[model samples]
Target: MFPKLDPILHSELRLAVMSILAGVESAEFSYIKKQTGATSGNLSVQIDKLSAAGYISVEKGFKGKVPCTTCKITPAGLAAFENYVNSLKEYLI
Candidate 1:
């Protein structure tokens, strides 16, 4: 039987965000936007969804007069991502 995939992490953009966050302690919104090639509007929507799901944390602040938004994966998010990958491996092997 195939393991169920995480709906929260199932999205292409959301998954990309998670993958990026998994490697770093935190990342800025602009960086994620650039890497995922998602428009600011769409990225914001997805970020909100992930934040609502408790998979990621969004922080907004100012960096030397410039507004900045940063995101980090939560422990729960990391676990979910790991499970998702392992489940995929089952199918690939």
Candidate 2:
């Protein structure tokens, strides 16, 4: 039997977000929006889901009077992502 994939990271946009965050210390909302080419509304919703899952941390602050949001993957997130990848291999075998 194949291992189950994480439902949270299963979405294309969410997976893409995680993949990018995995390679960086943190990323601004604009950066992720640009990289993913996702609309602000859609991306915000996904970000909320990831944050709620404790997979990522979302920080809201101001950057010289500009509202800025940054996201960072938590240790739990990295571990979950790793597990998700390992589980995916079950299908390839």
lDDT accuracy of residue 91 in candidate 2: 81
Q: Which stretches of candidate 1 lie over 4 Å from their true place?
A: none
- Model 1: per-residue Cα lDDT over 1-93, one tens digit each: 888888988889999999999999999999999999999999999999999999999999999999999999999888888999998899899
For each candidate in the order shown, give its overall lDDT on alpha carbons: 0.93, 0.97
Cα lDDT tens digits for candidate 2, 11-88: 999999999999999999999999999999999999999999999999999999999999999999999999998988
User: For residue 41, what is the lDDT in candidate 1?
Assistant: 97
Local error of candidate 1 at residue 89 (angstroms) = 0.7
Whole-model lDDT, candidate 1?
A: 0.93
Find the candidate with the highest lDDT and give its number.
2
Tell me how far candidate 1 lies from the true structure as C-alpha RMSD in angstroms. Answer: 0.8
